[model samples]
Target: MRLFPRAGPTASMVSATSIVVSGGIAVRGIGLLKLIYAAHVFGTSDAQDAFLEAFLLPSLLSDVLAAAVAPALIPALIRASTEGRTAGAVALYRAAFGAGLATTLVAALVLGLFFPFALPVLASGFGKEKSALTLRLLLVMLPLLPLTACNVLWRCILNAGNRFVLAALAPVATPLASLAVLYFGAARWGIQALAIGAVAGSAVEGILLAQGVYRLGYPLIPKLKGALNRLGPVLQQFGTILLSSVLFGCIPLIDNAMAAGLATGSLSVFGFGTKLATVILSLGPASIATGALPQLSRLAVVGDWRVMRGSLLHFGKLILLVTVPIVAVLMLFSGQLVRVVFQKGAFSTQAAYEVALVQRYSLLQVPLAVISALGFRLASSMAANELVIPAAGVGVAVAALADYQLRRILGVQGIALASVVTQLSVIATLGFLLKRRMSKQRLGVHTEAVPPGGDAL
Candidate 1:
């Protein structure tokens, strides 16, 4: 069909939404394959530990940069396009893209410089050979940061333009392409080849999504307009988003590091558990959100609070239906799942037990996980006083305090438990804020619907 959402029957919306969400599942599936491959190929050795450890910072950076740019781009672009202000809309897109690129470059440079010293502090027990390999791999991954940042901007622009299928499918190309590299190039060139392939995939994905955005009439020009006064609010909002995104992204990384500190193999176990948790909790919910965000922003832009509220509730119910079974299955069969999936070859039976234990703890947050995700995105779209920062701040505080308390008592398992606790606390806070927003939306609807009773202007 077409790239943009169109006026059609109810079936059309269902079909389109399914296509987008299915495309996300496809990409996520390939990503899972890549993860399993990496874990298998790298084994549970110290080199693998150091490699995963070194990847934490870069992965976190990639997430924060993308998160910072995406929410603003979506709402801003949707507003510009809906108002038919083509020039203003295109300018905003360009500005957001440029901002993401610049921010990522600066972060990479600073992080790369400090990575060597930081590695020792985090994983001092790791052997010197593995540490050196990790440091080198990290430096290579640094460039991927800017590429990933640019890709996220383009992907957000595409989604804002109602090209959800294209945006969702864009990620699949990277993993599929990397699967090729992982199988062939990795054997010949080693981890460096795998790193190169990843960067290449990022570049390709960015270009494809950027082209899709252009075709959909969102300009990719790198020009800026308007006064500093206008730019100030946008930048301020992004700063909060960036901070929140960094913390949201860093929690798993921090948990993994703490686990590794407790024991060498803990990082691998934590990584495997996280991948499984994200597959259940993050991937599907993210897909639905990606499809719905443009429509949600459209409703918000015109002050149609009833439709916006309905949208949130509809998606919330879906998340609940999907997550409950996942949490149940995970908790009931964590050991069996780990053993079946990762207990072959070098991964070992002992490794399976550790990962299963972590999975059991991590699975507790499943239901609230879905709720908090919707709450965060809904708050970001509302953009009133920019709520993402406060919500994210609560998460960071919870994670820090819980990590300190639990890491001492339970070791690796304690870190996972702390994560569950932090996630629940954030969900509680986000639930309150979402309720307040809904209340205001309801009041506004009643106020608008009532007659004026002969009041003077």
Candidate 2:
């Protein structure tokens, strides 16, 4: 028997895909279980809102720092390492780690000082006591910012080094750690336990990612120069990407926040629906997009326009293929889904209707949202040209304005509609931009290859 089985990039992709998809399933299962336990244990509108609100800034900040950098960092690092620029790859790691540490600390301080000011804006429906609890939770959760960002840096490095299985599986560590906090600590520590769980999860995730990086012969060090010089470009693009991600994300965030204010327990309803939608989006679309980044980057370097285009088309079709079925199921039996998932202990049938409404509306984004996420990742992976950001920003602005205008009139459902509309806008813009970039890459290849009107037949 051959000791080292013959394999190539294609085999790597197949194996990585299996690992990612399975990891997603595992994470999703943990998430479902946690939500069930939390609903039972916390069991109140206020408790749900407190946890969600405390989570809001940290979650969004993670998106801005870790996730924003993950796709961007992985492709660039892969290119650097493949081209024998080991120092450049190492420099990238150092820069990202420094940035994460600095950014997280700054964000934590800002949250500490300003969280009180923002609390009223976020949880306007809560009484002073509930609002204070929310604020306390925010302070506790803020520390996770730096911790989570470090986790992302390590994970991105590992993924770039083609250690996909560990990179994929590492995320599950956080949720499992959180489950322990909820199971044992919630009763004694109250909502603080949830916050502790998040922080502990971040620490575990960071350690796991760091261990994987070390195994791949990469060290975590602080390099100020590369981070400083290259950061301008990355940060500029990141700012736009952050805006786009936030704006797009703000749709549901605002919807959930607003609904929570309107009716008691409305927050939980919206949250339950959002989590369900996340299962589909994260497992299928996000997994594929993430899995494809390194390949896309390599294709860009080799000027493989045809393969890139075909890959993009495959991604779009893949999203539709997976999302259509999910949409059908959610549209047909949203209440049942919500009921089976929650609807016990503190959750009531009335809460189910509110959650069902959000879920049913979320079905509108089924195919569109999945395609948009793929488009964004695909565009970012193609040399980090930063085309997806402005287009996404435009969509977000549209969603925010629509959300504000429609929230009062249509309520939570309106918020969902706004989200759907913005996501469709993003899908359209990203699709067009991807085509244009592919054409440019093709034209550039043609111009460089054929010099002075000389053709050999």
Candidate 3:
């Protein structure tokens, strides 16, 4: 019913949250290191853009698919586990894997085929040489499409079984592989090494995750018929989720596409600007919010308005208190942070200034994102998924329109501002819908026809 936890606790809550956040930071640190290394090698060149753009697409597509797939698949797995020694659950896992394999292949095939035709128009700002390089890197990296899609599938399956350690650490493969490439091959192979490493790292992640799932006893052996037969219920749950996932995930792509039409290095600037915000969210509030979900769900189930509102407010305040100062420091030291993190190699003084400017704007997302994370968990605990879908759609629309209007006057900084605008609108809308839903007092414990394992988290 709710977002997610460690024994519904205070000290344990902190412990659980700390572990989640710290682990995320540790894992992501490797990837961030890879990026820093790449920055040194590539700077804001066509090569870097080509690597980022090449990498961004399949990654984005896989993430969008994973976002919707995991949540929808969870409910189905829980239901299946109630059947017979998780026999149905295992069957469903196989089915999901099979279907994911089939579908991701089809999607990748279509994308690979259409990319050449579509690239000229979508990335019209790309010159002949730049576009050609992006195409090469993308094709080399495309096989990861299946690797990534499968990684998402297995990761969700493992999480459903309460096996998260591997899921968390497994992602390190991507960055680790990339780092190796950047270190050993950057001079010889240039960005092609980056592309190759990405595909290889994803493959490693896929292997490790598949192993974990099998050890958990859900081997994803391929079976088309099984997948087709079991697809109905999952598909039914998938439609709304797909829309929200697409909308929410589109913001970066929107920025990238819009930035493609701008000056040569805009894509990297936009990415670098937003990088610290990502670190802040993952290292702090997002982790707490995720680990803190189960407690909020408990309170929601009790349906005590005073307790619910008070607990929610307190948690939100605590999250903000911990983060706001960090946000302030980051804003103040944006330039210094950029210099320390990415100013070496081909990166220059002027590029750092421009990146810092955008970073100041993008850093605003930290507080807004945490608030939204907590709010979304609250909505989930209240079973208000319906409210979130349209809110996300509205956010995506706002992002596109704002980026267009702002990019003209403000350039890349305007694009960063547009993201902030989207978050503000979505959160405001979600807050309103959540308030109305809470007023209905419809969040009481569900004793009627409870599912076999009860509501997860």
Candidate 4:
């Protein structure tokens, strides 16, 4: 595939890409430092395992809310703005913000209340002490649900307006706060310090993003009037995307549950490895996809299918160019990477080796995972959000089965392999569906030539 247009990437695209990628790298760098600190301080102890498991619910809720809303919302906002319907766009944002806040509040309350009963089932392997500790940490973390949802909503709004830097950089505070708290208080407060740090971080992140949104001239005071009318289509699209997210989101929970059933430190090892892989993902595919979404949405609004097709293809090549080499290096030097990052203080050489094993398999999914992320965003931009759900469902089922069967043989490595297989399966199925849809639409046939040096924003 061609790496670039004959004239090369436009200045606007290059500028936007650089801003998003650099911001993402900075955020991930802070996160990596936090992880390294956590590894050194907590290692793979039961306290660490409890903290990781406790974090699962709140983090999953945040991701699901963000993923479900952002893709659908950004496109709608772009379309409305393009059509000079700024009032309608602002109203829609309010409605989404209000609805998301309410939903997060309700979910947090329900989860908090029910966690006492559900903790046993979710972490069945934990003893009474560990399980109780997890419950306490979870309750403290529950407030993060609403804070995170708002932060994500504001970030999406800023992104839709092409203000990528602030949106991307605002999240850096979360890790910074967490790292500081852990550094100063881990001895006195133990795992609970992490929880406190997370809540503090979420607060900072939300405030910074909210300020960014306001500075962009979007109203923070939500106007719910006419929001329902504008939200009808958005909600419909969100439902399909949310369903897909929930289906795929459960895979990690399932993996964690299975890991809990293994040895004492299995959950920590798996969590560490997964976090490392996510750092790579956020830096490349996730960053590229985020930068591309606004452009894709604008293109779709203008019926620029030919350009959209070309853009998608170009993105695929770009993502692979970055992801493939990183995956290779990580797989080949997994032990070295793990030791360099995690083997300190409480983290033992054996712990590093175990994490390395899982990291190697998890890194295998980086390229496929990136492609799948981009594909889903492209599909959402075209209002084909419902198309990938079946593929995701199938992938999740396969992952569960694989986790069950593989864990019996390879332990944590088996779980990691299952995740890789799931991503591959999902990407294959989704890519085929996307290609078939584009073929049917004849998107490859250029209908109108885009002007040279057109800005993607």
**Residue runs of model 4 more than 4 Å from their true location after superposition:** 5-14, 224-226, 381-383, 435-457
Best by lDDT: 4
CA lDDT of each prediction against the hidden true structure: 0.69, 0.70, 0.75, 0.80
Clashing pairs in 2: none
Q: How many Å off is the CA of 145 in candidate 1?
A: 1.5
lDDT at 56 for candidate 1? 77
Candidate 2 residue-wise lDDT, 1-457, digit = tens: 2222245433344456567888888877987888788887775568777888889878877866654676556656766777898977777678877877887798789888998887877777878888888888888888788887778788777767677788888888777888899899987998788889888887887788888788777776666655777555445545555655665566556665676677666566667766777677777666765676666666655666456656556555644665698689778998888788778887777777777787888777767766766666566445433666667577867777877777778776667667788777777777787788768876884234211111110
TM-score, each model? 0.86, 0.87, 0.87, 0.92
Best candidate (score: TM-score): 4
Q: Which of the two candidates, 1 or 3, achieves a greater lDDT against the reference?
A: 3
Q: lDDT per residue, candidate 1, 244-305, as tens digits?
A: 77767767766666777777777777778766776765465555556665666666567765
Report the backbone clash tally of model 1.
Answer: 0
> Model 4, range 135-165, lDDT digits (tens) per residue?
9899989999989888988988998998898
